[model samples]
Target: MISVESAIIGLFSFSIVLLALSFFKKDKYKELENQVENLTMIVMQENYQLKKKMKVLEEELLGNESYTVPLNERYETNGK
Candidate 1:
């Protein structure tokens, strides 16, 4: 027969252990979460830089006199 006092102690101990295990899980993944966050930031920055470069390239190409005209312009000039 289990005593009421022992039952209460056992329940309290189990609750404490469950809480500790939950904390341990967070600690274990803390490092991995930081790594993933760092990687995401890096990728986003690189993507933004690439977009800027591409926009500059497009503008440069458009400003170049020797760049080919669109096919529609070619057709218009040819049909003139």
Candidate 2:
């Protein structure tokens, strides 16, 4: 028993509300995207620094004369 005019008006009002709600969601999504990008950049920088430190440690280990000798050799040399 609903009139066609009232039904049309109700549908139009519902569509308008849905559209407005979508606009609010869009802003929140954009803000979350920016935050994720910032976090990703920070993680990338830390990874690079860790890699650099690992490379330095590898070089130091390779250059160390003491490490060139085995543990058994160290014990034998010490026992002599």
Question: Evaluated with lDDT, which candidate comes out highest?
Answer: 2
How would you encode candidate 1's per-residue C-alpha lDDT over 1-80 as one tens digit per residue? 99999999999999999998887674767799999999999999999999999878877976754335776886788799
Question: Compared to the true structure, candidate 2 yields what TM-score?
Answer: 0.56
Candidate 2's residue-wise lDDT over 1-80, tens digit each?
Answer: 99999999999999999999887774667789999999999999999999999878866975754655777897898899
In order of appearance, the predictions have TM-scores of 0.62, 0.56
Off by over 4 Å in 1: 17-26, 64-80
**What's model 1's overall lDDT?**
0.84
Root-mean-square deviation of each candidate, in angstroms? 4.5, 5.6
Q: What lDDT score goes with residue 14 in model 1?
A: 100
Model 2 backbone overlap count: 0
**Deviation (Å) of 15 in candidate 1:** 2.0
Candidate 2: C-alpha RMSD after superposition: 5.6
